[model samples]
Target: MGSTSARTETCKSTSEREIAALFDRWNQSLQTGDPRKVVANYADRSVLLPTVSNTPRLDAAQKLDYFQHFLENKPFGRIDSRTIEIGCTSAVDAGLYTFTFARTGAVVKARYTYTYKWDGSQWLITSHHSSAMPEK
Candidate 1:
């Protein structure tokens, strides 16, 4: 006589719309004008390659510093176009976005990518890269 055991695996799935909404969450955080609120969207081990600065923000403090100055602009972001890719426990949303600074009435059109990971509880930005369009 032989005994066999069966293994059951559970998969977690996230929809494209859900992933897209994550950007809205982040953008709303920016509207708060609090760097800490914006930083809360990121994982502890994350990287931010921002649009306005050459420095690569690798840690919380660095990210906080960058956002402190950036938030001063009262930036509001809108996605121009985007593509979302879903993976197991991870997802990537990359696209073009435009930011309008309320303080200066300045608009910036940029190409951006946000890589997110499910940290067992919530999706957090693992890496965020944004660069201004070079043509103009």
Candidate 2:
């Protein structure tokens, strides 16, 4: 860890917990509908495979714009991350994501995956891809 943590708490041995905390912030900020804070979690040239639109969003700025556009169609929903798998300095966060529309009262649920890389201290989102659940 590079010791540049102000908002993130880090323990000596388990860095995964620290990294997961950072990811939780990402989820909270997104729930707040603050695209800027969501973008802040991404690296400069991160990639987002937003399956909602079936396109890839490259770069933090573009991803922010994507979030804004994407959020418009599907309102806000509760997001939860239940499981994470890590190896060395890289980790993948996977769990449930949902979008509840305000206009039609439709809720879309999906399993989301976020790939994170620990750059010494800070954990940055690299690739994010989400897919809707099968018709059930």
Candidate 3:
């Protein structure tokens, strides 16, 4: 008989419905019109490639900078198409979305992809990439 040491690892799994719910929560956060609240959805080590901004936000301050101006438009986003992929402790939601800006009464269609990670307690956005539609 051989003696062996046993180790245990904790794994987290998320469902398709749950991933959609996470996007819902993120959309709801944007409705708050508070940049801080919007930033809360992201992890400290997160990246945001915003729709309107040319800068790639790599830190909280940069993300806050983008959201500060973005929230001013009072943008409300709705998913037009969604494809969700779930993995162990991570997920990606990629699709098209439309944003209606109340301040300017402008409707912008965009492509978006959000990657999230389960950080022990809750899901946080790890990477967000969004771009406006190029077609006229």
Using lDDT, give the best candidate's number: 1
lDDT of 2 by residue, 1-136 (tens): 6778567534334455765676567766667667787788887767888857676889776788888866554466556655777766677778887877765688889888888876676778888888888877
Q: Give the clashing residue pairs of candidate 3, or none.
A: none
Give the C-alpha lDDT of model 3.
Answer: 0.93
lDDT-best of 1 and 3: 1
TM-score of each: 0.92, 0.71, 0.92
- Model 2 clash tally? 0
Clashes of 3: 0
What is the alpha-carbon RMSD of candidate 3 to the true structure?
2.5
Worst 10 residues of 1 by lDDT: 4-13
Candidate 3 segments exceeding 4 Å error:
1-9
Off by over 4 Å in 1: 1-10
On TM-score, the stronger of 1 and 2 is 1
**lDDT of each residue in 70-90, candidate 3, tens digit only:** 999899999999999988788
lDDT of 1 by residue, 35-94 (tens): 999999999999999999999999999999999999998999999999999988899999
